[model samples]
Target: MEISFTPEIRRAGLAGAGARLLGVAAVLVSLLLLLAAGPPAAADTTQVRALLHQGQDLLRAGQNDAARPLLLQARTLAQKVHFEAGEIEALRVLGKAELVHGSFAEARAFLTQGVALARRTPGQPGLADVLLALGQVANEQDDYPGALRACEEALRLYHDQGKLRDEARTRNGLGIIYSSRGDFPRALAMLLPALHQTQQLRDSALQANCLTNLGGVYFRNNDARKALYYFGQALPLVRRQPDQGALADCLTNLAVAHQQLGEFRQAEPFYQQAIAVSERAGEQAQLGVVLSDYAQLLTDLKRLPAAQTTLERARALLEKSGDVGTLAATLVALGHLHQQLGHGAEAETQAHRALALATPIKDWSVQESAGGLLASLRKRRGDYKEALRYTELAQAAHDTLFTQSKAEEMGRLQGDYQLSQERERAQALARTGERQQQRLQAQQRQLWGLGLGLAAAALAGLALWRLNRLLGRKNQQIERQRAELTELNATKDRLFSIIGHDLRGPLHSLHAFVELLAGPPLPPDKLAHYTQRLTHTLDHTLALLENLLHWAALQMGAAGPPRPENLDLAALANENIGLLTAAAEAAQVSLAHSLTGEEQAWADPAAVRLVLRNLLANAIKFTPAGGTVQVSARRTGAVWQLAVADTGRGLPAPTPLQELRPETLPRRAGEGGQARSTGLGLQLSRDAAARNGGQLLVASAGPGQGTTFTLKVPVAETVEVPV
Candidate 1:
């Protein structure tokens, strides 16, 4: 039926009775069937089944909230009946209802149990259906890979059973997964097959779903023309379907496609239509999404007031539904709209809220969008520093998402290419066999002229030998170049490692001591203590610098490292900690040393000291005031382990670290609390440890926790001085 395109409809409230009546009728029919097959003379079971049927009807009508209690009642009844299958079904339906209600955790618990039960039922299509539901749950949670796997498994089982319609449904689910992951080609591949199946089956509802998915894939792939084409195809099918939900989705897809094409007039109507359908169906979540889409469209169209109002309604609906992800997105849209309307404070508030929500979800798209909006707001308010921070975040988020998508696409393309190559090779082999037989027949006749053939062959062989020799020389040249490049990279890494490890001691000492001196004067005893500490710090700093300079010169092909020397790592760690004690105490942090007994490491003493000093100093700096920095050394088999653990701020999240590489080591923090380094300390420690026939490991338990830097060095029996 024709739904009204109004603000109320956009908020996801039901429209006129026609759509509701049909949904109710469907629910009644389903209930009747369920009752007819249910236990005889069980009034409680009947009532529960009826309520469940009513919920399903309400759900079909898009009245998620109204359906929730009924579904809950069904679950309670199923539990009372102790019917395992019935309970599973009740849980499954309840989970689906909860999903629509945005009760993700509750939904997950129900669906997970349903999946387990379904899996237990051998040779049943119910398992595939459960898998499909699980996939949708995962999709809602934004666990794209999990969703993809679930959908793939469901599709496989359905196909194996020759359940074409179920397979089509599963394929549509996969399309959604691939589309969300930015794998447009794969999404299209999935959607097209499902679309074909649905068309063959003449399932209008399924057809609409497939078409909508296809349209989304096209939209994401930047093929607006194709997106519009698919969306238009979906619209007619959705119109014919009894389910207005499909119609709503189709309308939204079409709107998005049209919007992207700059067909504002066409887009507006579709968005309005989608909102009307969602409202009529009482799908608040869907309605919120539709409202956000329309608001975004309005904002793009420069209709600020309308956009703001639309965004507010969407936000409210999302908040009511507890859809934080969508709510955040709505906030971001609202922020942008407010910013456009010159409302600075309002914009900032919205932007901050958006960021708060977006950060936890780890949805890069939402994060980037929120970041951009926040950056813009900051810039408009003349807060350049804050603006720059947000801008960088946005850029980083964009880069990460782009890189991930590109890598996945490249991997898929590579796989496809390899498969195609194998197929072609197989075909070529078959053709070659046929040709070889023909050649053998010809060769039989040619055997009579063997002497003439041999003379020509001998000349050809001599020419081939000369060409082979030339190619061999070229290969040797290429190999030599590769070796040179390898050596250069090694030299570069060595230089960086030295620079990173060696500079930390002096630089840190200088920074800390400067802070000390700039502060109020201390008593005579404390002054003397400071002086002694500063002197010790200088000695270690100078030694590290000397070694670094020498290493750099050596790396530049200028002189040499005499040879590896046996060094006492425990002594080195102790010496460095002694130097750092004053600075650590000045920061109100305690240095806990636990190096017992001597462990000799086979390395340049200078290099070992640098590694130990850098690690200790880093721990001290990052540890908050009153936090303890613990340094310990122990022998593990042939290696000496030196670890510096801090009870302070830990390492940042793993995501930023994933981008780090050897060359990018000694990473320095930018303006954003990012780890700033040339990423050198760990790399330097690693190199120094390796030089002594060992390795260095750095581990952190996330932000604000703690960090441990361990240096594993090979034990040496005798002290050997570098000649």
Candidate 2:
């Protein structure tokens, strides 16, 4: 059975295919015409035309200062002669020159005036050019949406006029606008076609611009080799033209591409050439950027001295020119350079300044760089906690940049996929046109299924990408926790070792004294001596055990808040002196006590008792035979100061009070060589005092000179007692 092919179905398929074909064909034709379009006609007067030409020539050569006066004269003369077209052209040139010199307001004023004049004139010939200049001004000011609007309008004008060359240039401008927004794929799509059209027209200057823009897109996309290839192709073309500014930019890009690839040796000469060209043309802004980049290259090459000099030069130029964008970058490079030179303070200063400058501008690249440098500087200075903070900030910035880059990549891929889908849709329509009516339905169904499948695949891919990112973050967190656990385990083992080492001597002495007491009774004199010795030994052992318990409580985070109460500083001092009096007499050390007034203290009573007992015992033990130990208390404003002074064997040298840890304290024999120390008592005392809102300070003048221990605590308020 032969199936009839309905005309209605055929027409439907043909119409759909034809519409898509027409749209594609129209875009291609428009691009071709733009490539062939000639330059705009000359101004009305010979003098106006000459002035405009000279100004444009000078502007192309990066001599904006020299070109401004000529353009101004042309504008004035054209206005005087009532030459609207000439005035428009002169205004356009002046606006561009002003824009290049960092005068956005003046450029906008001139360009807006030119646009207004072109509208009032009969033909409005210069309107598109004025709009294009305004778009560039918007781009320079970082107004992306404004730039896009202006460029699109100019593109429409050029398309309507069949001005292919102007359209090509506008397309390149659109690419640059997209690039500034970090949309690299969109940028490349606009730039590549423009480059092809410019090459076809054999416009050397335009072609060079297109090549440079393509290189920039590739550079931003991290395609360094392709960027290098395009930059190399543009270098000779820019040199051949009269555009010194373009040549300088080309040279700098080449140097950057090489430097990124670790080809520093090959990059140096290009940087030098770029710097020389910018300097000769008096392009201070461009010179500063080039010098800053060169300094970065020098810093990477370990040529620190040269990098510093170059950075200083760049800083001076950028500051004078008010180029904050480049200045921020220069400062980041300077910070890194200072870090490499071991000037930590200078590095930190520069990094902070860079962050401050870049933050207001929202220059994320500069901010990220400065944060990284600051992190490194902090780490080098041993400020690890603060270094970690900067590191996290830098990482966040890096992730943001990476996400932006990935989005651009996705946009490019999506654009390509959409183009392919359009082609397929057209092809399916063509096939439908050839098929019978019965098969047409089947083809339609097949096409719908294919589109749905493609969409589903795209969604799945995006979902998988997101899932992978989440897993990566989770893995990073797990790794960090694992490292922390490892460190904690090491600390636990060290603590156990210290506890065993400290407790061994005291335990052994206590065991020996217990065994002696349990043995047979002795004569009266011998028994008295044994009893006294055993008492001292038992006290020393008990003190050591208490210190260890306190330390363990502190380590375990079980030392709860201190219980503070009011107490007489003098009474506490006398109590401790009496407690240590027996030991002092046994050592043949004289004990003395003195107090003035009430000398009340608001402190944890237990902590104060431990502190006093430790200090008095240490003084008595360290004192030689016939040495005197003096305990005194006094009131100083709203604070109580207690001093424990001894004519004892002092510390061998000056030791920092802050560094008086248990491990650092000296273990020495007493006067009779019967008493030995564990060195934990002083550290424990200090820790206890600190917990009670008090401080223990030690002063010593070397061996054989007396040492004094001063304890300071807040005074308690006066309270009424029973009459």
Q: Give the best candidate by TM-score.
A: 1
- What is the per-residue lDDT of model 1 for residues 273-378, given as tens digits with 9 covering 90 to 100? 8888899999898999999989888888888898888989999999989888889878977887777788888888888888888888887887888888877776
**TM-score per candidate, chains pooled:** 0.53, 0.41
Q: Cα RMSD (Å) per model?
A: 13.9, 24.5
CA lDDT of each prediction against the hidden true structure = 0.70, 0.76
Indicate the residue-level lDDT of 425 in model 1.
Answer: 55
Kindly list the per-residue Cα lDDT of model 2 for residues 508-543, writing each as its tens digit.
445544544565554677567656665666677677
Report the Cα lDDT for candidate 1: 0.70
How displaced is residue 201 in candidate 1, in Å? 2.6
Q: What is the lDDT of residue 29 in candidate 1?
A: 64
